[model samples]
Target: MTQPNLPLLKWAALFEGSSLLALIFIAMPLKYMAAISTVVKIIGPIHGFLFLSFVAIILFYLLTRKLPATTTLIGLVSAFIPFGSFVFKAKYLQ
Candidate 1:
């Protein structure tokens, strides 16, 4: 991969990781500890942006690299689930 593409991939991974942490640790706890819906109120927008970026990066990578159709599909679909990016990183991204 080129240097330019590398940053996008890395950012996508970071966004995904942060969102996962927010969902699991911050959001989940907020719901029970304070009765505040932090996930939907605060973390939602952040995760939404991350998910969008992940999709954009996937499209950009697909166009630039010779990625398999299955990989592309997996990357696209994985953005919907919490911690999906981590799974993608473990299973697909090297």
Candidate 2:
């Protein structure tokens, strides 16, 4: 597979980060505080899909771009942390 272009990476990162934020700041709160399961049910799958897509791109670039092991590791790890993908994009992907 080819390395994803910077624009593609940026777009994916933006979407993945946004989904993570919504899942955490919107869905989680609604699920916990308001006893609302619907938002979580909706946002959770969306975030999961976005996150997986972001990670797949990361891995693809890791091979095609020959990224350092640390950078690859960071990309994967960031997917699990809220706002991490945004920070990663700014700090490393740029």
Candidate 3:
């Protein structure tokens, strides 16, 4: 059986993934290299919020939709690694 498509999760995953990239690539570089900490101060909390939202959405789907545990594990792992969410969406969320 095919799983239901979750657009919210897809968007959340995208946002979370981009935020992580922004934090690591843009924010960190500016903060450390240019001695400008303001960018991190702005991006860090945004990334954190996006990450939490992504995890919460994953948990909600796992419980309510009865998704496989491995999917949940993959979703959670995706939140940590930059761009992992995009891969997860392409592979699983389709």
Which candidate should be chosen as best, given lDDT against the real structure? Answer: 3
Model 1: pairs clashing at backbone N, Cα or C within 3 Å: none
RMSD of each: 3.4, 3.8, 1.7
TM-score of each: 0.72, 0.80, 0.89
Model 3, 1-94: lDDT tens per residue?
Answer: 2447888898998899889889999999999999999999999999889989999999999999656778989988977777899988888887
Model 1 lDDT per residue over 1-94, tens place: 2223355666687787788688778887888888888565778778778888888888878887755667888878878766778877766776
Rank by lDDT, highest first.
3, 2, 1
**Model 1: per-residue Cα lDDT at residue 54:** 85
Stretches > 4 Å off in candidate 3:
none
lDDT of 2 at 45: 96
Ranking by TM-score: 3, 2, 1
Worst 10-residue lDDT window for candidate 2 reads: 1-10
Instruction: List model 2 lDDT by residue over 1-94, tens digit each.
Output: 2332467677888999998889889999999999999999999999889989999888887787656678889888988877999988888777
Clashes of 2: 0
Count steric clashes of candidate 3. 0
* lDDT measured at residue 46 in model 3 versus the true structure, 0 to 100: 96
